[model samples]
Target: MTPITEVEGRRLALSNLDKVLYPATGTTKGEVLHYYAATAAGALLAHLRNRPVSFLRYPDGPDGQRFFTKNPPPGTPSWVRTTAVPHHEDKQARQVVVQDLASLMWAANLVVEFHTPQWQADAPGIADRMVFDLDPGAPATVVECCAVALWLRERLAADGLLAYGKTSGSKGLHLLVPLEPTPADRVSAYAKGLAVEAEQELAELVVRRMTRALRPGKVFVDFSQNAAAKTTATPYTLRARPEPTVSAPVTWAEIDECRAPGKLVFLAGDMGARLKRYGDLLGPLIDPDRAGRLPSAR
Candidate 1:
Protein backbone atom coordinates (compact mmCIF):
# COMPACT_ATOMS: atom_id res chain seq x y z
CA MET A 1 0.00 0.00 0.00
CA THR A 2 1.15 3.55 -0.59
CA PRO A 3 2.21 5.40 2.53
CA ILE A 4 0.32 8.68 3.02
CA THR A 5 1.77 11.13 5.57
CA GLU A 6 -0.48 13.06 7.92
CA VAL A 7 -0.51 16.15 5.66
CA GLU A 8 -1.03 14.24 2.44
CA GLY A 9 -3.60 12.11 4.16
CA ARG A 10 -5.52 15.20 5.16
CA ARG A 11 -5.36 16.62 1.67
CA LEU A 12 -6.49 13.40 0.06
CA ALA A 13 -9.16 13.02 2.72
CA LEU A 14 -10.66 16.50 2.29
CA SER A 15 -11.25 15.81 -1.38
CA ASN A 16 -13.62 13.05 -0.26
CA LEU A 17 -14.86 14.40 3.08
CA ASP A 18 -15.85 17.93 2.06
CA LYS A 19 -18.60 16.55 -0.15
CA VAL A 20 -20.02 14.99 2.99
CA LEU A 21 -19.37 17.19 6.04
CA TYR A 22 -19.72 20.62 4.34
CA PRO A 23 -18.15 21.92 7.58
CA ALA A 24 -19.48 24.98 9.31
CA THR A 25 -18.52 28.49 8.17
CA GLY A 26 -15.42 28.84 10.35
CA THR A 27 -14.85 25.47 12.02
CA THR A 28 -12.37 23.71 9.68
CA LYS A 29 -9.87 24.88 7.12
CA GLY A 30 -9.57 23.11 3.76
CA GLU A 31 -5.90 22.32 4.40
CA VAL A 32 -6.52 20.20 7.51
CA LEU A 33 -9.73 18.45 6.47
CA HIS A 34 -8.16 15.10 5.66
CA TYR A 35 -6.16 14.91 8.86
CA TYR A 36 -9.45 15.75 10.59
CA ALA A 37 -9.97 12.15 11.62
CA ALA A 38 -6.56 12.02 13.29
CA THR A 39 -7.25 15.26 15.09
CA ALA A 40 -10.40 13.76 16.55
CA ALA A 41 -8.36 10.75 17.65
CA GLY A 42 -6.44 13.11 19.90
CA ALA A 43 -9.67 14.46 21.37
CA LEU A 44 -11.02 10.95 21.97
CA LEU A 45 -7.82 10.12 23.83
CA ALA A 46 -8.50 13.06 26.09
CA HIS A 47 -12.05 11.82 26.75
CA LEU A 48 -12.06 8.03 26.95
CA ARG A 49 -8.75 7.54 28.78
CA ASN A 50 -8.93 3.73 29.26
CA ARG A 51 -11.46 2.38 26.74
CA PRO A 52 -10.51 -0.06 23.96
CA VAL A 53 -11.67 0.89 20.45
CA SER A 54 -13.05 -1.62 17.94
CA PHE A 55 -14.83 -1.24 14.58
CA LEU A 56 -11.76 0.10 12.82
CA ARG A 57 -11.37 0.12 9.03
CA TYR A 58 -7.60 0.52 8.74
CA PRO A 59 -4.68 -1.25 10.46
CA ASP A 60 -4.00 -0.35 14.09
CA GLY A 61 -2.93 -2.14 17.30
CA PRO A 62 -5.28 -3.88 19.69
CA ASP A 63 -6.75 -1.36 22.11
CA GLY A 64 -5.74 1.01 19.35
CA GLN A 65 -7.52 4.40 19.30
CA ARG A 66 -6.95 4.98 15.61
CA PHE A 67 -8.85 5.69 12.40
CA PHE A 68 -7.80 5.37 8.77
CA THR A 69 -9.59 5.13 5.42
CA LYS A 70 -8.75 1.91 3.69
CA ASN A 71 -10.38 -1.46 3.55
CA PRO A 72 -10.98 -2.60 7.17
CA PRO A 73 -9.98 -6.21 7.76
CA PRO A 74 -12.50 -8.96 6.85
CA GLY A 75 -15.55 -6.92 5.80
CA THR A 76 -12.98 -4.15 5.81
CA PRO A 77 -13.48 -0.62 4.43
CA SER A 78 -15.83 0.39 7.25
CA TRP A 79 -18.33 1.07 4.37
CA VAL A 80 -17.71 4.66 5.36
CA ARG A 81 -14.96 7.30 5.50
CA THR A 82 -12.56 5.92 8.10
CA THR A 83 -10.58 2.82 7.19
CA ALA A 84 -8.53 2.14 10.42
CA VAL A 85 -7.13 3.16 13.80
CA PRO A 86 -3.73 3.26 15.55
CA HIS A 87 -5.33 3.18 19.03
CA HIS A 88 -7.52 5.11 21.44
CA GLU A 89 -5.40 7.99 22.86
CA ASP A 90 -5.68 6.89 26.48
CA LYS A 91 -5.33 3.12 27.01
CA GLN A 92 -5.68 3.08 30.79
CA ALA A 93 -9.55 3.22 30.83
CA ARG A 94 -9.77 6.00 33.40
CA GLN A 95 -13.47 5.60 33.98
CA VAL A 96 -16.55 3.35 33.67
CA VAL A 97 -17.65 4.20 30.14
CA VAL A 98 -20.46 3.95 27.59
CA GLN A 99 -19.90 6.07 24.45
CA ASP A 100 -22.78 7.66 22.50
CA LEU A 101 -23.88 10.73 20.51
CA ALA A 102 -21.71 13.63 19.32
CA SER A 103 -18.72 11.77 20.73
CA LEU A 104 -17.04 11.69 17.34
CA MET A 105 -17.96 15.07 15.90
CA TRP A 106 -14.59 16.43 14.83
CA ALA A 107 -16.21 19.77 14.11
CA ALA A 108 -17.72 19.52 17.55
CA ASN A 109 -14.19 18.48 18.50
CA LEU A 110 -15.51 15.05 19.61
CA VAL A 111 -16.53 16.73 22.87
CA VAL A 112 -19.25 14.23 23.79
CA GLU A 113 -20.97 13.65 27.12
CA PHE A 114 -22.07 10.20 28.33
CA HIS A 115 -23.81 8.51 31.22
CA THR A 116 -21.25 6.38 33.03
CA PRO A 117 -21.93 2.67 32.74
CA GLN A 118 -23.86 1.74 35.91
CA TRP A 119 -23.23 -1.75 37.25
CA GLN A 120 -21.28 -3.77 39.78
CA ALA A 121 -17.55 -4.38 39.55
CA ASP A 122 -18.31 -7.63 37.73
CA ALA A 123 -21.59 -6.75 36.00
CA PRO A 124 -22.32 -5.50 32.49
CA GLY A 125 -24.40 -2.35 31.96
CA ILE A 126 -26.89 -3.52 29.28
CA ALA A 127 -28.92 -5.72 31.62
CA ASP A 128 -30.13 -2.39 32.87
CA ARG A 129 -29.12 -0.22 29.92
CA MET A 130 -31.61 -1.09 27.17
CA VAL A 131 -30.76 -0.32 23.54
CA PHE A 132 -32.44 -0.87 20.16
CA ASP A 133 -30.50 -0.54 16.92
CA LEU A 134 -32.49 0.72 13.91
CA ASP A 135 -30.39 0.10 10.81
CA PRO A 136 -31.65 1.09 7.35
CA GLY A 137 -30.16 -0.70 4.37
CA ALA A 138 -31.82 1.63 1.84
CA PRO A 139 -31.16 5.36 1.53
CA ALA A 140 -32.53 7.29 4.47
CA THR A 141 -33.03 10.84 5.67
CA VAL A 142 -32.12 11.92 9.19
CA VAL A 143 -35.80 12.29 10.00
CA GLU A 144 -36.69 8.73 9.02
CA CYS A 145 -33.96 7.32 11.26
CA CYS A 146 -35.26 9.21 14.31
CA ALA A 147 -38.77 8.02 13.56
CA VAL A 148 -37.44 4.51 13.58
CA ALA A 149 -35.77 5.19 16.91
CA LEU A 150 -39.02 6.30 18.51
CA TRP A 151 -40.87 3.44 16.89
CA LEU A 152 -38.43 0.96 18.43
CA ARG A 153 -38.72 2.69 21.75
CA GLU A 154 -42.46 2.07 21.73
CA ARG A 155 -42.06 -1.50 20.53
CA LEU A 156 -39.31 -2.43 23.01
CA ALA A 157 -41.20 -0.79 25.81
CA ALA A 158 -44.20 -2.95 24.94
CA ASP A 159 -41.96 -6.01 25.01
CA GLY A 160 -40.75 -5.11 28.49
CA LEU A 161 -37.42 -3.82 27.27
CA LEU A 162 -36.41 -0.35 28.33
CA ALA A 163 -35.25 1.57 25.29
CA TYR A 164 -33.14 4.70 24.88
CA GLY A 165 -31.97 5.96 21.49
CA LYS A 166 -28.76 7.42 19.99
CA THR A 167 -27.67 8.21 16.43
CA SER A 168 -25.04 5.85 14.85
CA GLY A 169 -23.89 8.45 12.28
CA SER A 170 -24.11 6.06 9.38
CA LYS A 171 -27.94 5.65 9.16
CA GLY A 172 -29.06 3.87 12.25
CA LEU A 173 -30.18 4.39 15.82
CA HIS A 174 -28.80 2.53 18.85
CA LEU A 175 -31.05 1.83 21.80
CA LEU A 176 -28.85 1.37 24.90
CA VAL A 177 -29.59 -0.98 27.80
CA PRO A 178 -27.64 -0.61 31.03
CA LEU A 179 -26.39 -3.88 32.47
CA GLU A 180 -25.02 -4.47 35.94
CA PRO A 181 -21.44 -3.68 34.92
CA THR A 182 -20.10 -7.17 34.34
CA PRO A 183 -17.59 -8.62 31.89
CA ALA A 184 -17.57 -7.47 28.24
CA ASP A 185 -18.52 -10.99 27.23
CA ARG A 186 -21.68 -11.00 29.29
CA VAL A 187 -22.90 -7.70 27.90
CA SER A 188 -22.35 -9.07 24.42
CA ALA A 189 -24.35 -12.13 25.33
CA TYR A 190 -27.29 -10.11 26.57
CA ALA A 191 -27.17 -7.92 23.47
CA LYS A 192 -27.13 -10.97 21.23
CA GLY A 193 -30.12 -12.47 22.99
CA LEU A 194 -32.05 -9.24 22.73
CA ALA A 195 -31.18 -8.72 19.09
CA VAL A 196 -32.12 -12.24 18.06
CA GLU A 197 -35.37 -12.10 19.93
CA ALA A 198 -36.19 -8.65 18.56
CA GLU A 199 -35.59 -9.74 14.98
CA GLN A 200 -37.94 -12.64 15.55
CA GLU A 201 -40.64 -10.40 16.98
CA LEU A 202 -40.26 -7.70 14.35
CA ALA A 203 -40.63 -10.19 11.53
CA GLU A 204 -44.20 -9.08 11.00
CA LEU A 205 -43.47 -5.36 10.70
CA VAL A 206 -40.48 -5.72 8.38
CA VAL A 207 -40.97 -4.77 4.74
CA ARG A 208 -39.61 -6.99 1.96
CA ARG A 209 -36.79 -4.81 0.68
CA MET A 210 -34.46 -7.77 0.19
CA THR A 211 -34.94 -11.48 -0.14
CA ARG A 212 -33.77 -13.72 2.74
CA ALA A 213 -32.76 -10.64 4.64
CA LEU A 214 -32.20 -10.20 8.38
CA ARG A 215 -35.82 -9.18 8.42
CA PRO A 216 -36.70 -6.37 6.00
CA GLY A 217 -37.75 -2.72 6.15
CA LYS A 218 -35.47 0.04 7.42
CA VAL A 219 -35.29 -1.47 10.91
CA PHE A 220 -33.60 -4.54 12.40
CA VAL A 221 -33.87 -5.21 16.10
CA ASP A 222 -30.07 -5.40 16.15
CA PHE A 223 -29.50 -6.95 19.55
CA SER A 224 -27.14 -9.60 18.17
CA GLN A 225 -24.16 -7.26 18.58
CA ASN A 226 -24.34 -7.11 22.37
CA ALA A 227 -21.61 -9.64 22.90
CA ALA A 228 -18.72 -9.27 25.30
CA ALA A 229 -16.48 -8.99 22.26
CA LYS A 230 -18.97 -7.13 20.07
CA THR A 231 -18.90 -3.38 20.49
CA THR A 232 -21.24 -0.99 18.70
CA ALA A 233 -19.59 2.28 17.59
CA THR A 234 -20.04 3.97 20.97
CA PRO A 235 -21.86 7.28 20.45
CA TYR A 236 -19.70 10.04 18.97
CA THR A 237 -17.28 7.55 17.43
CA LEU A 238 -17.10 8.55 13.76
CA ARG A 239 -18.93 6.22 11.42
CA ALA A 240 -17.61 5.55 7.95
CA ARG A 241 -20.89 6.94 6.66
CA PRO A 242 -20.86 9.34 3.74
CA GLU A 243 -20.41 12.95 4.88
CA PRO A 244 -19.68 11.20 8.18
CA THR A 245 -22.31 12.53 10.56
CA VAL A 246 -21.70 11.80 14.24
CA SER A 247 -24.01 9.62 16.31
CA ALA A 248 -25.60 12.14 18.67
CA PRO A 249 -27.91 12.17 21.66
CA VAL A 250 -31.33 13.86 21.67
CA THR A 251 -33.76 14.25 24.48
CA TRP A 252 -36.99 12.34 23.81
CA ALA A 253 -38.54 15.73 23.15
CA GLU A 254 -35.88 16.71 20.62
CA ILE A 255 -36.39 13.63 18.43
CA ASP A 256 -38.37 15.69 15.99
CA GLU A 257 -37.48 19.12 14.54
CA CYS A 258 -33.73 18.45 14.66
CA ARG A 259 -32.97 18.03 10.97
CA ALA A 260 -29.25 17.39 11.22
CA PRO A 261 -28.10 14.16 12.92
CA GLY A 262 -24.78 15.60 14.15
CA LYS A 263 -26.31 18.41 16.17
CA LEU A 264 -26.05 18.30 19.98
CA VAL A 265 -29.04 17.87 22.26
CA PHE A 266 -27.59 19.67 25.25
CA LEU A 267 -26.85 22.76 23.20
CA ALA A 268 -27.73 22.28 19.54
CA GLY A 269 -28.81 25.50 17.83
CA ASP A 270 -32.43 24.29 17.72
CA MET A 271 -33.44 22.35 20.81
CA GLY A 272 -37.13 23.22 20.51
CA ALA A 273 -37.60 21.24 17.31
CA ARG A 274 -36.35 18.08 19.04
CA LEU A 275 -38.73 15.76 20.89
CA LYS A 276 -37.60 17.43 24.14
CA ARG A 277 -41.22 18.49 24.49
CA TYR A 278 -41.79 14.96 25.78
CA GLY A 279 -39.06 15.29 28.34
CA ASP A 280 -36.67 12.32 28.57
CA LEU A 281 -39.15 9.53 27.97
CA LEU A 282 -36.29 7.11 27.45
CA GLY A 283 -34.57 7.94 30.70
CA PRO A 284 -36.81 5.86 32.93
CA LEU A 285 -36.28 2.86 30.68
CA ILE A 286 -32.79 2.68 32.17
CA ASP A 287 -34.17 2.38 35.66
CA PRO A 288 -34.34 -1.16 37.07
CA ASP A 289 -37.75 -0.61 38.62
CA ARG A 290 -39.27 0.59 35.33
CA ALA A 291 -37.49 -1.99 33.14
CA GLY A 292 -37.86 -4.92 35.57
CA ARG A 293 -34.32 -5.79 34.56
CA LEU A 294 -33.00 -9.30 35.18
CA PRO A 295 -29.67 -10.69 36.25
CA SER A 296 -29.49 -13.06 33.27
CA ALA A 297 -30.88 -10.95 30.40
CA ARG A 298 -29.05 -13.05 27.89
Candidate 2:
Protein backbone atom coordinates (compact mmCIF):
# COMPACT_ATOMS: atom_id res chain seq x y z
CA MET A 1 0.00 0.00 0.00
CA THR A 2 1.26 3.51 -0.80
CA PRO A 3 1.87 5.68 2.24
CA ILE A 4 -0.49 8.59 2.69
CA THR A 5 0.64 12.02 3.88
CA GLU A 6 -1.42 15.00 4.97
CA VAL A 7 -0.63 18.48 3.69
CA GLU A 8 -2.76 21.41 4.92
CA GLY A 9 -5.16 18.93 6.43
CA ARG A 10 -5.68 17.17 3.10
CA ARG A 11 -4.61 13.53 2.68
CA LEU A 12 -2.66 12.51 -0.41
CA ALA A 13 -1.45 9.04 -1.33
CA LEU A 14 1.88 9.66 -3.03
CA SER A 15 3.63 7.03 -5.12
CA ASN A 16 7.13 6.33 -6.47
CA LEU A 17 8.83 8.89 -4.27
CA ASP A 18 12.25 7.49 -5.22
CA LYS A 19 11.62 7.26 -8.95
CA VAL A 20 14.21 9.40 -10.72
CA LEU A 21 12.47 12.02 -12.85
CA TYR A 22 15.63 13.71 -13.99
CA PRO A 23 18.04 10.98 -15.05
CA ALA A 24 21.11 13.16 -15.53
CA THR A 25 20.87 14.83 -12.11
CA GLY A 26 19.20 11.90 -10.37
CA THR A 27 16.36 14.12 -9.12
CA THR A 28 13.63 11.90 -7.70
CA LYS A 29 9.86 12.39 -7.48
CA GLY A 30 10.17 13.06 -3.76
CA GLU A 31 12.69 15.82 -4.45
CA VAL A 32 10.32 17.46 -6.91
CA LEU A 33 7.48 17.33 -4.37
CA HIS A 34 9.78 18.83 -1.74
CA TYR A 35 10.69 21.68 -4.05
CA TYR A 36 7.04 22.53 -4.69
CA ALA A 37 6.15 22.20 -1.02
CA ALA A 38 8.95 24.56 -0.11
CA THR A 39 8.26 27.26 -2.71
CA ALA A 40 4.50 27.13 -3.36
CA ALA A 41 3.57 29.13 -0.26
CA GLY A 42 5.88 31.97 -1.12
CA ALA A 43 4.60 33.32 -4.49
CA LEU A 44 4.07 30.39 -6.84
CA LEU A 45 0.56 29.80 -5.57
CA ALA A 46 -0.44 33.41 -6.23
CA HIS A 47 0.69 33.18 -9.84
CA LEU A 48 -1.38 30.05 -10.40
CA ARG A 49 -4.30 30.74 -8.10
CA ASN A 50 -7.17 31.19 -10.51
CA ARG A 51 -5.72 30.17 -13.87
CA PRO A 52 -6.70 26.86 -15.44
CA VAL A 53 -3.58 24.73 -15.84
CA SER A 54 -2.29 22.42 -18.55
CA PHE A 55 0.07 19.68 -17.43
CA LEU A 56 3.07 18.29 -19.28
CA ARG A 57 3.57 14.90 -17.71
CA TYR A 58 6.91 13.08 -17.91
CA PRO A 59 5.95 9.93 -16.00
CA ASP A 60 9.10 8.18 -17.27
CA GLY A 61 11.35 11.20 -16.96
CA PRO A 62 12.44 13.68 -19.66
CA ASP A 63 14.27 10.99 -21.66
CA GLY A 64 11.09 8.93 -21.97
CA GLN A 65 7.73 9.68 -23.55
CA ARG A 66 5.85 12.78 -22.42
CA PHE A 67 2.39 14.20 -23.11
CA PHE A 68 0.36 17.39 -22.61
CA THR A 69 -3.19 17.44 -21.33
CA LYS A 70 -5.63 20.15 -20.32
CA ASN A 71 -8.21 17.77 -18.90
CA PRO A 72 -7.79 16.66 -15.32
CA PRO A 73 -6.36 13.17 -14.99
CA PRO A 74 -8.67 10.41 -13.84
CA GLY A 75 -8.86 9.87 -10.03
CA THR A 76 -7.95 13.49 -9.33
CA PRO A 77 -9.01 14.22 -5.76
CA SER A 78 -12.48 15.71 -5.42
CA TRP A 79 -11.02 18.48 -3.22
CA VAL A 80 -8.93 19.71 -6.14
CA ARG A 81 -10.47 22.76 -7.80
CA THR A 82 -11.23 22.63 -11.50
CA THR A 83 -12.82 24.88 -14.15
CA ALA A 84 -14.39 24.27 -17.53
CA VAL A 85 -12.25 25.59 -20.41
CA PRO A 86 -13.55 25.87 -24.00
CA HIS A 87 -11.35 24.76 -26.85
CA HIS A 88 -11.89 24.00 -30.58
CA GLU A 89 -15.54 25.08 -31.03
CA ASP A 90 -18.04 23.15 -28.86
CA LYS A 91 -15.72 21.14 -26.66
CA GLN A 92 -14.93 22.27 -23.12
CA ALA A 93 -12.21 20.67 -21.00
CA ARG A 94 -12.30 20.42 -17.23
CA GLN A 95 -8.87 21.71 -16.15
CA VAL A 96 -7.13 21.82 -12.78
CA VAL A 97 -6.76 25.05 -10.86
CA VAL A 98 -4.11 25.11 -8.15
CA GLN A 99 -5.52 27.40 -5.47
CA ASP A 100 -3.57 26.24 -2.43
CA LEU A 101 -0.61 24.15 -1.26
CA ALA A 102 -2.36 20.79 -1.30
CA SER A 103 -3.61 21.18 -4.86
CA LEU A 104 -0.20 22.49 -5.98
CA MET A 105 1.68 19.53 -4.48
CA TRP A 106 -0.86 17.09 -5.89
CA ALA A 107 -0.29 18.44 -9.38
CA ALA A 108 3.46 18.69 -8.85
CA ASN A 109 3.56 15.00 -8.10
CA LEU A 110 2.34 14.22 -11.62
CA VAL A 111 3.39 17.18 -13.73
CA VAL A 112 6.88 18.03 -14.97
CA GLU A 113 5.78 21.36 -16.44
CA PHE A 114 2.79 23.58 -15.44
CA HIS A 115 1.38 25.81 -18.15
CA THR A 116 -1.34 28.50 -17.87
CA PRO A 117 -3.04 30.82 -20.29
CA GLN A 118 -2.90 34.61 -19.80
CA TRP A 119 -6.57 34.87 -18.80
CA GLN A 120 -7.98 33.68 -15.51
CA ALA A 121 -10.94 31.30 -15.07
CA ASP A 122 -13.48 33.96 -14.16
CA ALA A 123 -12.63 36.21 -17.09
CA PRO A 124 -12.24 33.69 -19.88
CA GLY A 125 -11.86 35.92 -22.92
CA ILE A 126 -9.92 38.75 -21.33
CA ALA A 127 -6.20 38.66 -20.67
CA ASP A 128 -4.52 40.34 -17.75
CA ARG A 129 -0.98 39.82 -19.03
CA MET A 130 0.93 39.90 -22.31
CA VAL A 131 4.01 37.76 -22.85
CA PHE A 132 6.89 37.79 -25.30
CA ASP A 133 8.76 34.50 -25.52
CA LEU A 134 12.27 35.36 -26.68
CA ASP A 135 13.64 32.18 -28.23
CA PRO A 136 17.24 32.07 -29.36
CA GLY A 137 18.11 29.99 -32.38
CA ALA A 138 21.42 28.01 -32.19
CA PRO A 139 24.41 30.41 -32.21
CA ALA A 140 22.15 32.87 -30.37
CA THR A 141 21.84 31.65 -26.81
CA VAL A 142 20.08 33.29 -23.85
CA VAL A 143 22.78 35.93 -23.80
CA GLU A 144 21.40 37.31 -27.06
CA CYS A 145 17.92 37.10 -25.57
CA CYS A 146 18.97 39.40 -22.75
CA ALA A 147 19.85 42.14 -25.22
CA VAL A 148 16.51 41.79 -26.96
CA ALA A 149 14.72 41.75 -23.59
CA LEU A 150 16.34 45.05 -22.60
CA TRP A 151 15.15 46.70 -25.81
CA LEU A 152 11.65 45.31 -25.41
CA ARG A 153 11.52 46.55 -21.81
CA GLU A 154 12.21 50.11 -22.92
CA ARG A 155 9.65 49.83 -25.70
CA LEU A 156 6.98 48.52 -23.30
CA ALA A 157 7.63 51.33 -20.83
CA ALA A 158 7.08 53.86 -23.61
CA ASP A 159 3.60 52.38 -24.09
CA GLY A 160 2.88 52.69 -20.34
CA LEU A 161 3.35 48.98 -19.72
CA LEU A 162 5.87 47.68 -17.20
CA ALA A 163 7.38 44.34 -18.14
CA TYR A 164 8.91 41.64 -15.96
CA GLY A 165 11.57 39.16 -17.03
CA LYS A 166 11.98 35.48 -16.23
CA THR A 167 14.03 32.59 -17.52
CA SER A 168 12.06 30.21 -19.76
CA GLY A 169 13.98 27.54 -17.82
CA SER A 170 15.13 26.45 -21.20
CA LYS A 171 17.32 28.32 -23.70
CA GLY A 172 15.19 31.48 -23.80
CA LEU A 173 13.74 34.39 -21.78
CA HIS A 174 10.08 35.43 -21.23
CA LEU A 175 9.01 39.05 -20.80
CA LEU A 176 5.53 39.57 -19.35
CA VAL A 177 3.54 42.78 -19.20
CA PRO A 178 0.71 43.00 -16.67
CA LEU A 179 -2.37 44.51 -18.30
CA GLU A 180 -5.60 46.04 -16.99
CA PRO A 181 -7.97 43.34 -18.19
CA THR A 182 -7.67 43.79 -21.94
CA PRO A 183 -9.26 41.59 -24.57
CA ALA A 184 -6.93 38.78 -25.69
CA ASP A 185 -7.09 39.83 -29.33
CA ARG A 186 -6.10 43.43 -28.61
CA VAL A 187 -3.23 42.30 -26.41
CA SER A 188 -1.93 39.94 -29.09
CA ALA A 189 -2.09 42.65 -31.74
CA TYR A 190 -0.19 45.10 -29.54
CA ALA A 191 2.42 42.50 -28.72
CA LYS A 192 2.85 41.61 -32.38
CA GLY A 193 3.30 45.25 -33.30
CA LEU A 194 6.04 45.59 -30.72
CA ALA A 195 7.74 42.47 -32.04
CA VAL A 196 7.67 43.95 -35.54
CA GLU A 197 9.09 47.21 -34.22
CA ALA A 198 11.83 45.38 -32.34
CA GLU A 199 12.79 43.48 -35.46
CA GLN A 200 13.03 46.67 -37.52
CA GLU A 201 15.09 48.52 -34.92
CA LEU A 202 17.36 45.63 -34.01
CA ALA A 203 17.38 43.75 -37.30
CA GLU A 204 20.76 42.25 -36.55
CA LEU A 205 19.60 40.63 -33.29
CA VAL A 206 15.81 40.23 -33.44
CA VAL A 207 13.53 38.28 -35.78
CA ARG A 208 9.72 38.44 -35.49
CA ARG A 209 9.00 35.70 -38.00
CA MET A 210 9.08 32.02 -36.99
CA THR A 211 11.05 30.97 -40.06
CA ARG A 212 13.80 28.59 -38.94
CA ALA A 213 16.17 29.82 -41.64
CA LEU A 214 16.01 33.43 -40.41
CA ARG A 215 16.67 32.49 -36.76
CA PRO A 216 20.32 31.34 -36.89
CA GLY A 217 21.87 34.17 -34.87
CA LYS A 218 18.74 36.10 -33.91
CA VAL A 219 16.20 35.94 -31.09
CA PHE A 220 12.63 35.16 -32.19
CA VAL A 221 10.11 37.36 -30.39
CA ASP A 222 7.10 35.04 -29.97
CA PHE A 223 4.08 37.29 -29.51
CA SER A 224 1.36 34.73 -30.05
CA GLN A 225 1.31 33.55 -26.40
CA ASN A 226 -1.22 36.29 -25.65
CA ALA A 227 -3.89 34.36 -27.56
CA ALA A 228 -6.74 32.97 -25.49
CA ALA A 229 -5.88 29.38 -26.38
CA LYS A 230 -2.10 29.37 -25.86
CA THR A 231 -0.40 28.77 -22.53
CA THR A 232 2.96 29.75 -21.05
CA ALA A 233 5.01 28.09 -18.33
CA THR A 234 3.87 29.49 -15.01
CA PRO A 235 6.56 31.39 -13.14
CA TYR A 236 8.50 29.45 -10.47
CA THR A 237 7.41 26.09 -11.94
CA LEU A 238 10.06 23.42 -12.55
CA ARG A 239 11.01 22.73 -16.15
CA ALA A 240 11.79 19.21 -17.40
CA ARG A 241 15.36 19.62 -18.51
CA PRO A 242 18.49 17.54 -17.86
CA GLU A 243 18.39 19.18 -14.42
CA PRO A 244 15.56 20.60 -12.30
CA THR A 245 15.66 24.11 -13.70
CA VAL A 246 12.89 26.58 -12.81
CA SER A 247 11.08 29.30 -14.70
CA ALA A 248 12.48 31.74 -12.17
CA PRO A 249 11.49 35.40 -11.99
CA VAL A 250 14.39 37.84 -12.40
CA THR A 251 15.26 41.46 -11.81
CA TRP A 252 15.96 44.06 -14.48
CA ALA A 253 19.34 44.88 -13.02
CA GLU A 254 20.31 41.24 -13.34
CA ILE A 255 19.12 41.15 -16.93
CA ASP A 256 21.08 44.32 -17.78
CA GLU A 257 24.27 42.95 -16.27
CA CYS A 258 24.16 39.40 -17.55
CA ARG A 259 27.10 38.96 -19.95
CA ALA A 260 27.18 35.17 -20.05
CA PRO A 261 24.42 32.66 -20.72
CA GLY A 262 25.24 30.61 -17.61
CA LYS A 263 24.81 33.65 -15.41
CA LEU A 264 21.04 33.60 -15.97
CA VAL A 265 20.45 29.87 -15.57
CA PHE A 266 18.83 29.05 -12.20
CA LEU A 267 18.15 25.59 -10.86
CA ALA A 268 15.54 24.49 -8.28
CA GLY A 269 18.16 24.60 -5.54
CA ASP A 270 18.81 28.29 -6.09
CA MET A 271 15.16 29.32 -5.54
CA GLY A 272 15.10 29.27 -1.73
CA ALA A 273 18.08 31.59 -1.41
CA ARG A 274 16.78 33.74 -4.26
CA LEU A 275 13.43 34.12 -2.52
CA LYS A 276 15.16 35.03 0.72
CA ARG A 277 17.18 37.76 -0.99
CA TYR A 278 14.72 39.19 -3.50
CA GLY A 279 11.34 38.14 -2.09
CA ASP A 280 9.53 37.53 -5.39
CA LEU A 281 11.10 39.80 -8.01
CA LEU A 282 7.96 39.48 -10.10
CA GLY A 283 5.61 40.74 -7.39
CA PRO A 284 4.82 43.88 -9.33
CA LEU A 285 3.22 41.81 -12.04
CA ILE A 286 0.53 40.67 -9.64
CA ASP A 287 0.06 43.96 -7.84
CA PRO A 288 -3.22 45.55 -8.88
CA ASP A 289 -1.86 49.09 -8.60
CA ARG A 290 0.92 48.33 -11.06
CA ALA A 291 -1.23 46.96 -13.86
CA GLY A 292 -1.00 49.04 -17.07
CA ARG A 293 -3.46 49.73 -19.84
CA LEU A 294 -2.63 48.99 -23.45
CA PRO A 295 -2.34 51.98 -25.77
CA SER A 296 -5.08 52.21 -28.43
CA ALA A 297 -4.18 50.04 -31.40
CA ARG A 298 -2.46 51.91 -34.24
Task: Candidate 1: list runs displaced more than 4 Å.
Answer: 1-49, 55-131, 139-148, 155-161, 183-193, 207-216, 256-292, 295-298
TM-score of each: 0.47, 0.97
Tell me the whole-model lDDT of each prediction, alpha carbons only.
Answer: 0.40, 0.90
Worst 10 residues of 2 by lDDT: 85-94
C-alpha RMSD of each candidate structure in angstroms = 10.8, 1.1
Backbone clashes in model 2, listed as residue pairs: none
Question: For model 2, how does the per-residue alpha-carbon lDDT over 19-138 read when each residue is reduced to its tens digit?
Answer: 998888888988888889986466898899899999998888878888998889988999999998877764766789999999987888785599999999999979999999999998
Residue lDDT tens for model 1, 128-153:
34345666554444455566556556
TM-score of 1: 0.47
